[model samples]
Target: MNKFVDYFKIGPVFTYFIRVFRKPDPNAPTSQNLRMMHGINRISIVMFLFCLIVMIVRACTR
Candidate 1:
């Protein structure tokens, strides 16, 4: 379906999951890198919570 294709085409979710599971880059040795890492961590947490809320709402509505 077009919706499924579109979902996978914008690969942010997949990339986020990969980043969540992958080890932190040992070569990162700067304050900017640390800040970026924190940002990514926060984004991932928010995305996860949003997904959880959506699923709960859908289930309740059904």
Candidate 2:
């Protein structure tokens, strides 16, 4: 049971997930391409999470 519980623990991936939504560095150099890329990434991340929640809800309802 303990091992099963440990298997679901949040790890380094959680840090990366948080990093994605955090404020960007003020001093970093900016570019049109880089900004567009990050914007797309943020949108995809939100969409992916929305789909994940939908799937989980459907699974639980069944």
Candidate 3:
């Protein structure tokens, strides 16, 4: 007799998104190049998610 099934699991993509949005460590060394790279990555990730949502909505409407 199971009370609840373990159907929900946080995948790697979700974890990556969380990591990307999380605040940077105060003690960690900072580099301009690294910051710019992460900024670009964040922008790309946002664009990809927007496109994915749009595709899904279009599919569902049809």
Model 1 lDDT at residue 37: 80
TM-score of each: 0.50, 0.69, 0.73
1 versus 2: better TM-score goes to: 2
The alpha-carbon lDDT assigned to residue 48 of candidate 1 equals 81
TM-score of candidate 2 on Cα atoms, chains taken together: 0.69
Q: Pick the candidate with the highest lDDT.
A: 2
C-alpha lDDT of all candidate models, in order: 0.79, 0.86, 0.84
Off by over 4 Å in 3: 1-13
Query: In model 1, where do residues sit more than 4 Å from their true spots?
Result: 1-30
Q: What's the lDDT for residue 26 in model 2?
A: 85
Tens digits of lDDT, candidate 3, 1-62: 24344345448668878888778888999899978887888999999999999999999999
Q: Is candidate 2 or candidate 3 better by TM-score?
A: 3
What value of lDDT does candidate 3 attain over all alpha carbons? Answer: 0.84
Expressed as tens digits, the lDDT of each residue in 1-62 for candidate 2 is 99998998888777867776778788989799978887888898899999999999999999
Worst 10 residues of 2 by lDDT: 12-21
